[model samples]
Target: MWPLPVRPERSYSGEIRNFSKLFGTERNRFGSLHKLTLYYLPIAIFVAVYVLIILRNLRWFRIPVWTIMMAGAVAMIFSGAIPLGDAYASINLNVIFFLLGMFSVVAGMDLSGLLEYLTLKLLRVAKSPQKAFGLVLIGISMMSAFLVNDTLALMATPIMLSVAKQLRIRPGVFLITLALGVTIGSTMTAIGNPQNLLIALSTGIPNPMLDFLYYLAPPTLAGLGVTYLILRWYYRKEFANSTLAQLQVNPREAIKDRKLAKLSGWAAGIVVLGFFLVGIAELFGIQGNFNLGTISLLGATIVFLGSGRRREILRSVDWGIILFFISLFIVMQAFWESNALQSLMIYLPVLNRSDPGLSLVTIILASAFFSQLLSNVPFVAVYIKAMQAAGFTGADVKAWMALAGASTLAGGISLLGAASNVIVLEEAESRGSGFGFVEFSKIGLLVTIPNLLILYLFLRVL
Candidate 1:
């Protein structure tokens, strides 16, 4: 039962031709649409997400930053800007794991009240308000150099507020000092903040911890000194004749859980030791597979196993930040894949491979500016790729260090410039005392300019 042969013009190919003619070339139109979606949609999503994040404080658009980033990532996936598998692969699990471990260890310290106890002990050395202010800046910044700055901001805010109350001054000045201190101090070490950690792990730099300290510590110390002088002069009236000797602060009272405090303190110490050991080994030409992430996770494991209050500590971890990084990776991956930034990259200062001095200046300036817009971590993630594209490599130690320093100091340029600033602000606001954006920026500008100059000069000389 053979069917009747179909006419040549009425074939499937003929139907496609007819459909193309009727609909103005369906394939071409679809192709153009797909290209538009792939090439341009991610950029729109990226800008929209950033806008939402910047305006999130507005009453009408009060959304969590993490939610905005997560939504953008989803949009990218759904819009076909990037594939699902690639999106999944884009997330740097090492970063996520490292953050989780550090957060857990810090959480244990915070929940056990060890951080407050130690903070008060450090600040107790101040006999006068001026001295106390200096102590606060130095102590918090030093702590931030080892502990991640955002976590320190969270732990230090209430303590600083209490110190302010004890000193009989407004909390505003102390909050600003803290915001700047963390931003400056975290520049000195790879594990000092999330962005620094990202740079350390992503750049494939050998002995990152040692390299960071060697390059950044001088600038950080100088920056802290400058910060102290600036704050003292800027708020001289607030601390004039203010004697901390008259106010009694008992550090022992800050300890809530003695056992947990002991355990967490030891755990933190071990982590720091571990970091140094790894760096020293690398310096001596010995190499190991264990990285910062593994060392931190080991410390976290110690806290989890030894502390009875592990659940409470775990709950205190900033999962939103973890989620933010995860989402950010996907969104940035999509943008990178779409080649949206290629045009813009050509306009950036040329990162000369031969003249690192020229590259250093360019990297520092660019990092300082864009960090304000995208925040340090996201900017570093994007900029690292850009640096590589411009012929910089892991062996360009000075350039990478410049990036770490500038991006961190840039956080002190504005309130929204660093995650630590946001943490401090949110913590202060919840306690009914906080500095406004403009108020912070005023002090921030004074602090950031000198710090950036110091960083650049030190990097150049070193």
Candidate 2:
């Protein structure tokens, strides 16, 4: 038989029209509806049903919270809410690969007993409860800067809980400390947080380790100092009768498998080195870069093939978080293609201004506030296009960069505020030392208020 001609892909409008037929239910709307009844009726029905389901949380037709979010994202993307571009997809791929590599290396470290051994040794050196708190704060912070806050919190929370149980101190307070430390530390590097990556990609900010510190370092120092002081005041009564003498645990005892520890450390080091090498190579505009994710997968493959630890690593990885990013990336791409974000920027009163510094401060404050409401990653992507459309210059770009950084930092102030916050809290809870949102937000407010102001002031000075 003669082959049937392949039809051209239907336009988006055509596809939507076809999908509309599935939900076509007649309704008497105010006795007589307008001429565009078919389109209007179906949309009205969909909206009514959707709102009802949401408000009632109906069991029969309920969707997962994530799926609902993705649906809104689809609307926003086509409606110009997000405004991420094709270029963003490439950047995201790099980010995903980098994260994958990092995760693999971290998995190896966890399985190899390196992280556990290091945790114990660090704790042992900390001896007294006060010192232990300090070390835990510093260690988790440093790890987060390199490994990202989410991973650092996931792996470290249980270990911190174990230490708290042994030392007989309040784990909740320390858990808070660990959580804040990671949030603060994450501001130091682009790889530390998703928003940081967005800022880097959008603003063309290079050497985040250095560029970020121009604004972030000072605030982070203030945050760290403030965090310490806050913890001290809060925990002063707790530490009043205790000492920080190093706990008596032999280093050898902590190393369950020295061979595995060495292998894991080496693998992790290679993954980290890849980032540094890529950063350096960027100076010459070279490609062939392997990101954190790819490096992690490589390390994971090694561990899986050689150490027989693939199953455990796969089970342990945050698959949900990974999928969230994938969906997020697609939606962001849609926003970029649709130019939805640009339209939103046109509507923002702050960007329709003449003063550069004022524009800078406004963007910073706006980003900080919205980040608390919307996820920082999406917020960053949206505003980045807004800032660009507003004709941000070199210095203006710097201001926007600072704004993105501060917005993410603001997330440190609330529990329902950031992904990292939820991850850390959930992990701690899993180990029987969970914290409440009210409690965390109470402490977070103290940190966020002052820290955001400091960030604003620093940006003004620059």
Candidate 3:
């Protein structure tokens, strides 16, 4: 079957007749809605797998998320919901390789003991329990602005569990603060997280790093303050009258292989520089199309070659999550091809020349629950595409900025809101301390709603 639908050439009158069914217009093109019903079977299969996967913890069957998503992708292809060529086209290789490269680099950092070193250093600086919690929060926030927060969360959570035991601090506060800070600081920079990276790469964002810092940093910083207060308020007894338990840990002991560390660190530097120089250099008469994925892959190659145990570090690249993202890209494209997102254009006011404040508010409100419903990354992809169809182009600087701000901020709205939160929860559980979905949401609401409201007001005045 052809990957793209073949539509009959119709006059204005005929098109007007089909206007109400635009998103599902395939029915009209096929001559009957019944003929197109089976094409949507993949959606049902995908939804069933999705629901069951989320319930895996209830039973002893521990199926990975990647498994379910890939099953959906395969089912869609087999059922002709998405053609083979369309499925291939739907996967964004850039995002996949970008994630793999970053994961490889962080895996090297793990080999060099950098994660342990940084985690220990952050813990040693606190003089008391309150100071410790605050210090940890700042460290996580700062680290997330540049490094991948998921990597940080995976490595840091175990160390934090150790801190919880020694310092007698509540594991809930320490873990939750880490989750909050990771989400908040990620909004400060495009490179901090995946959603930001996607927005930065998509057209309409100018000077990604500079633009984010200037516009998003203010509210994100403010939100961090709110996160701190709410956490302290909720965990007041946990933070009060705490003794400084000198860490029995020494970071130096972990660095038997400094050679891999230095190589990984150098590779990270090169990749970061490459990201900044990619398109900016073109403005200065340098002619080349540089991509973050290729450059980061180069960094990964460097680490792989230098590290003697390439197989071991390569094995740790979170391949499951990467595959999950790839399958997700394809499944999401089905919705896009069906014009499901384009239909949202009508609800959104014209973003090209609309009031900046109103546009910001609309994007924020829509992205908040939208993200929770389908996850932030998918929502951003659909939202950005929808707005572009609605006349919000790269020239609409405010629109894209609003998207980056609202999408990233809204990722903290619930437990399913962001990958980092889920990572922390899963990782914490492995270490014998983790909260349920209800507790996470209860804590999240205490800070998220108020912070989002303040940001809405702040944007209105700006």
> Candidates' TM-scores?
0.92, 0.76, 0.83
lDDT of 3 by residue, 165-200 (tens): 777776776787778788878877777888887787
What would the C-alpha RMSD of candidate 2 be, to one decimal place?
10.6
lDDT values of the candidates? 0.87, 0.64, 0.74
* Residue 169's lDDT in candidate 3: 75
lDDT of 2 by residue, 303-409 (tens): 55666566766676665555555555655454444444544555564674477677767876786677666656656665676677677643454565566667677
lDDT of 1 by residue, 207-299 (tens): 898999999999899888888998899999988756675566788988898988888899899999999999999988987766788888988
RMSD of every prediction:
4.0, 10.6, 9.9
- The order of the candidates by lDDT, greatest first, is 1, 3, 2
Output the number of the lDDT-best candidate: 1
Clashes of each: 0, 20, 1
Give me the candidate number with maximum TM-score. Answer: 1
* Candidate 3 lDDT score at position 372: 76
- In model 1, where is the ten-residue run with the lowest total lDDT? 240-249
